[model samples]
Target: MRPAPAVVAMGVAGCGKSAVGEALAAVLGAAFVEGDRLHPPENVARMARGEPLTDALREGWLDAIGQRIAVSVASGQGVVAACSALKRSYRERLRGFCKDIVFLYLEIDPATAKQRVGSRPGHFMPASLVDSQFATLEAPAADERALTLDATRPVGDIVASAVSLLGEANS
Candidate 1:
């Protein structure tokens, strides 16, 4: 049997990780997992207040997401997860969980991200924290397992690009 594919959609807030991840999962015939749902209420509240989450605050959340990936891997299920794995260390934690893991970095400019965040209603992530996200983000270039997609493109295009990248990698 072919090994299961585990794709992680990663980026800062408002980079369309959730949207792209869901679409990519559908395209790839994989199960979709939204990482934000795994965040503890305290972490959510902190981000909602425009405060950056400290490593201590993010540790449990990262572990939870990593464990979920491990579960999917063990089940032989293809999984696509939406998460802001902003740091290399965080990505490494996920790498420890699944051997077939690939990261899809949704690259976007700050202005576009801020506009999207501001226009979106009823979202906990405030536009004011966009700068902080940029500051915290460590782009995942140089990682051969990573694919950088321009998130400013249309959703259809983004999904197509991700699908193509995944297919190429898995082939």
Candidate 2:
């Protein structure tokens, strides 16, 4: 049997990772995992206070997300995860769980990201961290199996494009 499919919808804060990931998962009939929910309380608290998370603080969170991906792969079920996998190393850590995992990069300008994040309410991540997110980001290189999309596009359009592309590859 074929291995389960996995897709990580990744970007800086305010890039609509959660919204896009959830919609893509629904279209593909896969489970959606909000990476933020896996963050340790301290991490969430720090972010809520408008502080950026250090790499040390994020290590455990990344491991937790990787563990969830491992479980889904073991269960032979697909999963779509929304994470600000801002660095190549972070994506590499997730790839340790499933080498074939696809990454959907929501490419957006800092202004747009800040605007989107600022408009959201009741969210832990603040607009103050937008610059930090972009600062840490390392876009996937040409060799990586990543899809880059303009995050300013509509959610439905993004998901539809993802479904069409991933369907051909995953099928």
Candidate 3:
């Protein structure tokens, strides 16, 4: 029998990773992990002050999240996760822990990302850092276990579409 699906909803801040990840988890009947909350308090404080985190700063956090995903899947507790996963190396690191991992990249232009982040009430990521987020992002390539969707879609629509693809893959 096939193991359950483990998904990561990935993008820059304000691209709806949390909302969509939660919705997809609901649809898939999987556990939801909020990657933003998994960030260390110092990382949160630094970003809240409008600082962009360096790769070195994000390594441990990424590893921790990857471990959670692996444990969940190993236990047959499938999950949907939200993580920025901005760079290719970061995605690859997560993949190293779970080769069957699937990434759903929510692609957004810088202007929209900045606009959304600016309006967000209490998020640690400031609009000022959206540019750096874009600079770091590497959209999933064709060969990867991933899908890219427009980030501007309605939450329901995005979740429904993702369910179709994931359900198909699982079948």
Candidate 4:
């Protein structure tokens, strides 16, 4: 049997990357990695204080995710990771680790994102940073192996779409 394909659930903070990623992973019978948990302590503190992370600050976090992707790919076990790959460069960096990785972009508007972020009690990212996330985001280009979906939809619906996409990609 062919190995399951890796997927990255990517978007701004409140775009439901984690929810979709977890659901997709469960359906795919693949491992799920919450990218937020991999952030360094200092980065978490900065985000909690509403400070946006510079590219330099995010390097280590990206590296950690990349390492995990490499491991999963090498083992032939798929992984679904929730990450805010805001910049094109960041996504490119991750692609270096796994050539077949597919990006699932959860498209969301700023108002909804801010509302969601504000309602989430303990997440390190603050609602105020929603603007910065928008500022930083470079939606996946046409050539990239990516699937874009509406984040405001129900999680089950989103996961269903992702599963369909994965099935197509894997075939």
| lDDT string, candidate 4, 62-125, tens digits | 9899889889878988899999988889998898888788999999999999999999987888
**How high is the lDDT of residue 96 in model 2?**
89
User: All candidates' lDDT scores?
Assistant: 0.90, 0.90, 0.90, 0.92
Return the clash pairs for model 3, or none: none
Clashes of each: 0, 0, 0, 0
- lDDT for each residue of candidate 2 in 31-115, tens digit (9 for 90 to 100): 8899999999999999999889888888899888888888988898899999888889899988988898899999999999999
Q: Over the stretch 13-71, how does candidate 3's per-residue lDDT look in tens digits? A: 88999999999998888999899888999999999898999999999999988988998
Better of 2 and 4 by TM-score: 4
lDDT tens digits by residue: candidate 1, 98-150: 86789999999999999999998998889999999899899996954899999
Model 1 residue runs over 4 Å out of place are: none
| TM-scores for the candidates | 0.96, 0.96, 0.96, 0.97
